[model samples]
Target: MSINTNQFPADGNISGLPDVTELEKLANELFSLLPNEMPKANFSPDLADHPRLEKSLNLVHDRLPSLFSKGEGFNLNNPQTSLPDPHFPVNKTPQSGFGVSPPAVRPGNELSLNRPVSPNSITTNTDYPGLDHKQPSVAGSGISPSAAHQGNAVNLEDPQTSFPDPNVGSSVGLGHVPHSVAGSGISPSVIQNGPGYAEAFPFSPDTPFEPDFNKLWSSINTFKSTPQIPEIPGTGGAQYYFLQGAGFKGNDPFGINQNPTSQLSGKTFSHIQNGAGHAPFDVNLIKKDFPILQERVNGRPLIWLDNAATTQKPKSVIDRITYFYEHENSNIHRAAHELAARATDAYESARSKVQVFLNAGSVNEIIFVRGATEAINLVAKTWGEQNLNAGDEIIVSNLEHHANIVPWQQLAAKKGLKLRVIPVDDDGQILLDEYAKLLNPKTKLVSFTQVSNALGTVTPAKQIVEMAHQAGAKVLVDGAQSVSHLRSDVRALNCDWFVFSGHKVFGPTGIGVLYGKEDLLNETQPWQGGGNMIQDVTFEHTKFHDAPNRFEAGTGNIADAVGLGAAIDYVNKIGIDVIHQYEHYLLVYATNLMKDIPGLRLIGTAPDKASVLSFVFEGYKTEEVGAALNNEGIAVRSGHHCAQPILRRFGVETTVRPSLAFYNTCSDVDILVETLYRLRGAHR
Candidate 1:
C-alpha cells in the first residue's frame, strides 16, 4: 500500500512521525550544502515514482538539523567518526558541485594519518563518496513494504522510474544517520534557520540541557588542594590523647609519665626513671611494643634483624602521623588559619627535638635533607666548591658507604684535587696510623662513616675529627649505620658535619637529619634555591636566609617528620642506655653462635663493633646463606653492602650481614644458628 500524502502537519511538532512536505524541506537544506552539478539523478538510478521510498527518504531528510547540533560530531554507526575530522578529504572530481581544489602531495612530507595535514593543501573531503544517492524501490533490496514501513533503509540498486532528489543524500539512502532523523525527515528551512538546530532533540518540548564545565573544574581543584585523611583507631570511649593515671600504671619506671600516657598533660616528661617499682628490664616487654614482632614468617615468628638497614616503627610513631593528618593538616609559613599554625608549630617542634637528639649546638645547625646522600652532596657542592682548588687533598675511608665516597670523588675530579683513601686492614678496621700519615696541611677535608654499613666496624669519630683538625681539615661523619645503635653527641665528637636517615632509627622514610657545626653551616652558601629557603626576593637580586632555611629549598615531608619526632619520643621513653646495652648483648650472643658454626667465616672482627655480624659459608655462597636464612623467617642482607673496596681489602668476595637492634632477642639468634647449620649440612 503506497500512499503519497504531501504537506507537513504545520503544528511545529512531529513527536512521532514526519509528513511528505517536511521531508522535502530537509532535502532542500541538504542539497544547498552541495553544488548544482551532482544531484541524486547522477548517483542513484531509480527514484521517480516509488512512493514508499520517497516517503522514507523524506523522513531521513527532515532529521538533518538534529544530527549536527551535538557539541562534538558523532557517527550514527561508526564510533571513530565522533571526533571532528579536519583532514577529511572532500571529493574534488570534475562532476562534484563544491569548488574545493584537488589535494596535492608535497615532496618532503609523508601522507599517513599520524602526520599533521599541511594547512597549505587545497582539497579536504569531510563527506564520503556517492553522498547524493537515493533508492527508488524498498522491495528489490529485501526491505519491507509500505511508506512508513520502508522507513530509512532503501536500496539504490534498482534502476526503474525515480525522482532524483540530491537533497535526500546518502543519509536517507543507507540509513547512516540516526533512525529518528532518517524516519522523520523535517523541513530544511526549520533546520537551517531555527533555535532547535543547536540542541540535542529538535522538536521536544522539554527544556535545554547543557554541561557546566566550570562547576566540574572547581570540584577537581578542591580535590587537588585537600590533604589525605589519616585513619584513627577507636579504643572504646578513649580520646586521641589519653593520660594514664596511677591506677593504669605500667611496669616501666616512667609508668604514668609515658608519651602515650602523658601526651594529654601540659608538659610531658622526657627523663626516664630507673626506680625499683618496675620489674627487671625485660627484652620481651620491648618486643611487644613493636607490632611486627608478632607477625609470622615461614612457619615461625619473624626475626627482623635488619635494623642497620632499617628499623620497624612502634605504635607511637604511627599514631603521631595519624594525629597530624586528622587534626593539624595544613601548609606551613603561609596559611593564617589555626590548623596551619599548629602544623608549623609541630614541624618546628620536631626540628628542635632533633637538635637535642643529635646534641647539635643549635636547631639552625640541623638541616633536614632528603637523606645522607643529599646531605653529603650539600657539603660537596657548598664546602667543596668554595674550599677545594687544584692539588688540594680530600681523604675518605675504605669503609665508607658509596653515599659517603661518591660525593667526595665527584668534588675531587671537578676541582682537580687529590683524593686520598685511609685503607682498612684484613679485619675490615680502618688503619688509623695510615689515616694519621695521610693528614697534611694540603688535606682540606676528611669524610668517613662512624660505623661501616657492610662490616659493622665502629670507627673512632672523635680521633678522626681531632686528627683532621690537626691538619686544619674539616671532618664529615656518615652516621647512617651508627645513630640507631649508639649515643651520638655531635658536640662531643666535634665533627664539622654528621648525617643520618630517619628510617634507620625506626622513624619515617624520606626524612633525615644533617647536623653541622653552627658556624660551618652559616658559612656554607645556599646550594639549591627555591620556596622555603628564600628571605626577601627581587627579579635582579635575592637575599637568602641563614643555614637551615637556606638548605631546605622545597616543601618537606611534614607527616614523616612528625613520625620521626614520635620515634625519638618513643626511644627516649625506652631509654637509649638500655637500647645500647640490649643490642650489645645480642651482638655478642650472635657472634658466639656464628663462631660455633663450622665453615662459617665471620668478617670484620673489629674489637669495637656495632651489632652487625657479617659472615660467609665455605660450601655455600653469601647469597645462598642469606636465602637459606630468609626461608627460615630470618631476614638479612647479602653482597657488597655498598662497601665493595672494604670487602675486597679483607681478601673476601662478599658476606651475609645480619645487623641487630635492641628489639632483636636471643631466640632470633638461635633461629639464625639453626638455619645456618641446616644449610651447611644440605650443601655439604
Candidate 2:
C-alpha cells in the first residue's frame, strides 16, 4: 500500500488512514509468524505442532476464536476511557506527552532543522501527542478482530491486548520506519546497515517482513550446500526471518551451526538472501573460537548475556596478547631494538585498525587511552577547557551513560557553563524535536551515546551530529556500547570525536580509542605530557609531538593494543554485518519468548534498538530475577547499569538486562526463556 504522507494534517493528526484490508492482512500475518511452538533440537517441519509454546504465549493474552479489542478498552480504540489490565499496573497520572511529527514536505532540495519548524509542520509536543509514560499490561479484549486490526491511533500494548506495536512506543502516536525496507522483503543488506532510524513506525518496517519465497527448499538439511542469509530481525517475531531461502530448512539443531566463522567465506552479502554463493553463519563454529564459552557454570553451560558490561575474549585475541608478551614485548618508540620495532609496529597497527574500523581520516587522529572514561576526560580537559567559555552550554541526551554525562557535568561546573539535556519519549528514544529546541547560539558542544548501554537504544547518531554541526557546535559520540553491536562509521557520523573501550569490543580491558577529525585534532592541544610525547625539552618550554603521539603521555597498554588489532581482524574475518544480523536474531527470539510472562515490563521498546532487553517483573525485585537467571547458568545485569537518569526517567531504579553478542545462539535464548518461565510458575 503506497501511503501519501501529505494527506496528514499540520498537527500530525493522521487523516485518510486508508487500506483497512491491507492493515488486517499485515496484523494477521504478524500473529501467524509468532512461534506457535518452539521446536526442539531435531525439530518438526510443521510450525503449528507446539501446544506448550502456544499456552506459554497465551499467559498474557485472553484466548478467543480470533483476538480483537473489547468494549470500553481498545485492542485498537480510543484511550480516554480504556480499561486497564489486572496483571500489570498502569501509571494513571498523565504528564506532558512527547511526540514528533513527520518531516514537512518541501519542494526544494535543501532542508535543515536549524530553522524553526514550519507552521505547516507537526511537532511532537504540539501535534498528535502520546499518552502517559508508563507501559500498560496486555489485558483481555472482547472486541471484533477486524475492528482491532484496523491499526488505529491506539496503544498496541493497551493493557488489554498482548500485541505489541513494531513501530510505536508503549502508547500510540505515529511515525514512519526507516525507508530502507522498500525492496526484497527481508534483505539483510539494507536492514543491517547502521542505525539512523527515525522514531515510531505504525506497522512492520517492511511492508511484508516475510521469509524468502523461491525454489529455496531443494537443499533441505544440506547445510553445506545452502547459502544462508542473516537478518536484522524485525520486532517480536524477528528470529523467524533467519529461515533459509523460501522455507524452513533442517539446519543447526543446537540453534548453532557447527561452523559459523566462514559466513563470508568468499562473496559479498550485497545479495544476502539469493544464496549469494557464500557460506552461512555458523554459531557453533564461532563458539569454538571463544574457549570461555566452554566453561560450565554451576555444572551448566555458561550462557553469557551481560555483554553490555564486557565481552568475552575469543582465543585469537588471547593468543595475540600472549604472542606479544613472548615475542614482541617492549616499550614503544623509546628504544631501537628488534622487540621495540615489533612493539611499535604492532601498537601502530592497532591504531591503524581502529582508524579503518571507524573509517577515520588518518591514524594520527586515533589516540589510545585507559578506556572510554579516560578518553572523555582527555576531551574535557583539552578541547572543552580550551574552547568552552563561561556562559556557554553543552547539550547531552537523557540517554547518555554516566561516563558521557559526568565528564561534561564536571567541565560545565568548572567553566561556569550551563549543561542542558535533550529529553526522551515513552520509548527510550531521544526526542529529535526536543533536541532541536535545546540548541542555541550558547551551545558549544553536544555529546551523547551512540547506543544506550542500559536500554539498547540505537540513537540517530548521524542525524544528531548533523544537527549539532548546523548549530555551530562540535559533537562527541560515546560509542562504548555501539561499536560492538553495529557498524559505526565516524566519517559518516561526522562527529568531532568518537570514543569506545577495547573490552567492550572483544579486546583488552585497559585499551580504548578516541578518534578525532584530522583538522580538529591538530587544532587542539594534548592533555598529557611525557617522555615520548616531547620533540625537545628545556627548562623554559618543550615542543610537543602531533595529536596521537602527544596524547600518549606515558607507557600505554602496548600488548593489549596488539590484541585489540587481532580482535578487529577476527571481527573483520566474520563480517560485522553478519554479527549484527545474528545478534538481532538472538534478541528477537528472546524478546518474543519473554513477552509471554504475565507481568514482565519491557523497559526499552524502541523500534530501532540494539541487542539489549531491559525489563522488570512484577512481585519480584530485579536482584531476585537476576539471581534466579544466574542459578540457571544465565548471566544478566540487575542494577542501575550506571545509567540512573534514563532508568529513573522510566520510573525504575533497576532492571534485569540481558544483552547479546554475535557468538550467542538461539539455544542460549531458549535456556533464558525457559528459566524465566520456571520463575514465573514458582511465583504463581
Candidate 3:
C-alpha cells in the first residue's frame, strides 16, 4: 500500500506513516533557522536605575534576548549597537527603591560572563538572579555601602581585595570567612546589610551580626603555649623514695615491720634472760616449765615420746589462757566496752608475736585457723579453685600428711587436674632430683611437708621451694613438724605459704597459723564467709575486706591464740638456736642407741633427720610394742600417724613412732632404747 507523506488517517491508526526521506527533509528545515553561534551578553544592572525593573530587564535580556529586543532587532556582530558594554555605566538617576548606584565602570574595560568574577570585588547586582534593591541581598557585598556610594572601584584581580564567591549566596561564606573584609577597613555590620546581601547568608537587615575576634585570638594563643614537665628528685626514681624515704625507713614493703634483732631482748625470761646468749641448754630447767611432764602414767614417770602427735602445754601458755579468760575474755573488734578493748589488744598482739616468730614481713600475712589442716584446705579451696585448670598437675611429695594430701586430692578430682607425686628415697627423704624432674610448666603447685611426721625425715625444704619457684610453681611448706623442732624463718625459706599447728608447737590445741606472702594472700579469695570479713553487704552484692580479715571470717579461737603467743614467747626466751641444737643432739643419741637392738628394724634412717625414731620388731605387732611402752609410762604413736603414703612407702602399714621435743632428755632416750631391747629379747 502507498503511504501519504504529510497526512495521516482520520482514525489516528498508524497503518500508514511518513517515509524516512520525508523525516530527513523536515529536520533540515528546523536546523537552517538556528543562529550559527549564540551571542554572549553581559547584563550588569545599574544599581542607581529602577533596581527592581532593571533586574527583571537584565534577566529577560540575558535569558531570552530575542523576545526582549524583538522591536530593536539585536545583532551579535556589532559591539556598540549590540547589548550595552558591561564596562560602561548607565545614566544614574534617583529611582524609587533603587537606593544608590555602584561606582562608575571604566570605559573600554569589559567583564566576561563565562569567566567567574573574583569573590573580593564589589558584588554586581546581577550576581543574584531574583534579588532587587527593595529586598537587600542576605550575602552582603565585600565593599561597604559608603565605599560604593563614594565610588571606590574594587580591583577584582587582587587576592587581598577578592571576597568569597558571591555565588556562595551566604553572609557567612561556606567554610571560613575571608580575611579580606577585615583588612578592607569596612565595618562587619555594613557588609552584613549592604548590596551583596542574600537569604543564604546568616545575617540580614532584621538580624545585625558581629564576631568577637579578640576572644577567638586569645583562645588560639593559649592553646599554643608550651606545657611544663614535672621533675623527680632522686637517682632511682620514685622507688628510691618508697624504699629509703623518712616515712619508709625500717618498714618492709611486703608488710613486716618488726626488727628481728630487737625481738631478742634480755627481759624475755628471768632465769634464761642473762644466759640466753651463752646459756647452756638445761633439759632439767626446761622441764620445770611443763607441769604435765611430772605426772605419772601407769605408776611410772610420763616419758612423752609422742611429741610428733602433740606437744605438752607450758606454764606460760596455760597462765596466758587463764589470764585471757579471767581478765580479757570477750568477743573482739565488735564492741566499745573495756573487755572488748582488752580482748582485741590481746588478739592482735598475738598476731604480731606470730609475725615476729616466723620472721614474716607483715602481721597481715598471718591467718589463724583450727590447725594446719584447715590452713591447707583454705589454700586448696581459694587459690586452688581459682588457679587450677583442666589437665594441670599439682605436685605433692610422698612425705605429705593426710591433712595436706586429702584437700588437694579432692581439688584435683573436682578440677579434672592431675596429682603428680615426688617419690622419696629408701631413707624416707624426698629425692631432690626426682622433685626437680616432676616440675614442669604444667605443674601448678608443689605442696610438701618440711618434716615427715611418720618418718622424721627432714626434707631439703629450702632447696625444694627454690626449685619449684624456678619452674614457675607455687610452694606450700607444711611446717607442722618442723615448726616445733626447728626455727622457722619464712623470709629465708621464701615459700609462697607456710602452715603450722599451735598444739604441735607446745601451744594450746584448736589453734594454728597460716603464713602466706602478702601479695598471694591478697590475691586469694576467702574460703569462708560470715560477720567481719565483709566491708559492706546487701542481698544482691557484697564487698569483702582485705587479706587476714577476709580469710578470718568469723570469731576466732581467742584464748588459744593468746596462749600460742605465750608459747612463742617461751620459745624465744629459751632461744630457737639452742633448742634446735639440743634436739639434734638428742636425735643423734637416740639413733645410735636404737641401732644396737637385735630383732628390731629402724625405718626412716635419713642422714638428716628429726628426733623421731620409727621402728618395727620382728615377731611383734606395732600395737603390741605401743602397748608395752604405755605400760611402762612411755607414750608413742603406733599407727600410720595420719601419713599413710609414707608408711606404705616404707613397706609397712604402721610403725612404733617415738618422737622428741627440746625438753626430751638423754635419760628419756636411754629408757626408750632399754625397753626396746627388752621387747627384742622376749621376742627371741
lDDT of each: 0.61, 0.64, 0.64
On TM-score, the stronger of 1 and 2 is 2
Alpha carbon lDDT of residue 629, candidate 3?
Answer: 93
TM-score of each: 0.60, 0.63, 0.60
Against the true structure, whose TM-score is highest?
A: 2
Q: List model 1 lDDT by residue over 165-198, tens digit each.
A: 2212222133222111221222222322333332
- Higher-ranked by lDDT: 1 or 3: 3
lDDT of 2: 0.64
- Alpha carbon RMSD to native, model 2: 25.5
- Candidate structures ordered by lDDT, highest first: 3, 2, 1
Per-residue accuracy of model 3 over 1-684 as CA lDDT, tens digit each: 111223323332223333333433443333233233311122123422543334433543453333223222111122112222232222222122221112211222112233233322344455333222221121211223333343342321121232332322212221222222322222222233232211122222242111222211121111111222111234221111222222323432211122222321111111111123333334554675689999999999999999999999887677667757866788988999767776787788788889999999999999999899999999999999999999899999988889989999999889899999999888776788888788899998999998889888888889998998998999999999998877899999999999999999889999999999999998888888998798999999988888789999889998899788878877776677667655754565566557667877888877667778899888899999999999999999999899988888888999999999888876677677778878877776
Q: By the TM-score metric, which is better: model 2 or model 3?
A: 2
